[model samples]
Target: MGVCGMLRVVQTGIGGLDVYDVQTCPVPKPAIGEILIRTEFAGINYLDVLMRRGEYTSTPKLPFTPGCGIVGTVVELGSSVNGQSGFAVGDRVVVLTQSGGYSQYVTADARAATHVPEGVPSDKAVCCVSSYVAAHQLLHRAARVHGGWRVLVHSAAGGVGTALTQLARIAGCAVYGTASAGKHDTVRGLGAVPIDYRSSDFVVEMSRNEPDGIDAVFDPIGGEHWLRSRRVVRRGGIVVGYGMRTIRTAARMLVASRGRRFSYYSMNTRNVLQNTEDLRLILNLCSENIIDPVIGPRLPLERVHDAHRLLTDGAITGKALLDCR
Candidate 1:
């Protein structure tokens, strides 16, 4: 915890988490036009899970720290970085780091970081970069959802789901959300028509309720769920596939249900390529404010294992966060 030393969670090459105690590396010296941050909080996302499992299409080299979004106070600035350019030494900010968020400190391109408003807590700001920004990008820009549109969002109680539902409602769209039965009320409270994905055929239910069909479907649960989504969306209605949660779940379930006789890799590579394009649409929603991500259970840095357990167990309602300070 000394100024000259740092504590970081390192990913072992074998796909395990290990905490390393090292002399705080010199506060990452900011390069020209960069800023150093004393991180206060970090957002743990599903991408982090994929990164850990070595399942993501692109993986960082081994032994790297994993954290994508962070909120902190600026501590140092590079000479080419203007302290007065809408920021100062003490400014509260959130950064979209490609990595390095699991540590106590970070250095990032000044342009990729944004100053937080006065009233928003650092934790909330942390949500903005990944969850909120992603939600905004997907719903408004990618989907082009608008008033009177009928939308269906998978994982409604989740971070991205919650954000999309809220923003859709704000845009005057009617939203239907899928979640476990236990989370239905939570989704309803957010102003979405809730569908219990565990017990219902969402496509059938939506068809029964709105036969004209949905205008857009926000599906992070890819794989088989993609087919189900297609059924609910009207022709020309877009289905945005951002995550492989459904595919991963299907793979695990296939192993459990068939007792080692099934493999989930039968899907074609063309499908994967198309799915990535769907994700790009979600990213475009960020600047439009349509998908605002929801903040879920938060844990201190020391409890990272607990956070991982909660996420893996499907017990959290939204994105989990690591309070790094």
Candidate 2:
């Protein structure tokens, strides 16, 4: 909350980053089974770009706030939010809102919130909400990767990419990441073999490295990229797609899936229970140092335009967060 009865938020219409603007309005009140959070950090995801550009199939109506996840302290709880919700005022929590997370304060469903472990940092906990959750599901639920398996993660140096690599290593699988040359060291440091997707043909590179075909390929870069990803996966292995560039890209992926397994993963509230459980598991992993989330550049909420610019220009590695405090 700001002075008066106001709160500041990043608002935008359906357009490019330039359409984004910071404005002040009355602080939002929680509805039944909702919680109001004094936000600490909000994740800046690639999905935001898709939504901003009107490329995503679904999006909020014009003049809306765009943010998918956040880490904050619960400040108020609405009616019927009972003890079982495990939320109390001043308790730190991470939430997956799918929108409205870029404000100084936000309201989220109590059921969609998870308590952050005592020792976990806000930055790391925020990553667990969307990036790590998606990575965990893509591997455990979609790909069903196991120990001794080899997997390739596209955008290996990005937020979800970093999470995928780290979690894969923890599961005793060998990991290969395709990233720009500059991010190779970061990928390699995560115990993954880095392939420069810009300079080298990843399909050929993976073929040379694994020859027998790799176990799984986790790709968010859709379209013919999925076709290329499919070529490297072993006969029994699968290609999991998450991000969509376009409907045609999705169609291309499905057509390319012939004679191979192709699975698509989306992080949504349809399975709130499973997502909350996985988020808690990821927070615990972060607390124990089992998997350290790679945090990249952070900017104050007012500088959100720059944050979006950094993400769009591919100038960020790992997760980029907006400091909402």
**lDDT (CA) per prediction:** 0.71, 0.87
Q: Give the TM-score of candidate 2.
A: 0.95
lDDT of 1 by residue, 1-325 (tens): 2377656666665454433222234556888888888889888877777778777766578767788888899988887888465667988877775567877888877767776766666666677666666676677656777899988988889777787788788789999999998888879988999998778788789999889777778877776776677677775576776778647543334222311121122112223233334333333443354444567887877677778778877888877888778
Worst 10-residue lDDT window, candidate 2: 1-10
Model 1 Cα shift for residue 318 (angstroms): 2.1
Q: Over the stretch 36-134, how does candidate 2's per-residue lDDT look in tens digits? A: 998999999999889888887777787788898999999889999877778889899999877898888888999899999998989889988999999
Q: Estimate TM-scores for all models.
A: 0.82, 0.95
In model 2, the runs with Cα more than 4 Å from the true position are: 1-11, 246-248, 252-258
Deviation in Å, model 2, residue 264 alpha carbon = 1.2
Report clashes for each candidate as comma-separated counts.
15, 0
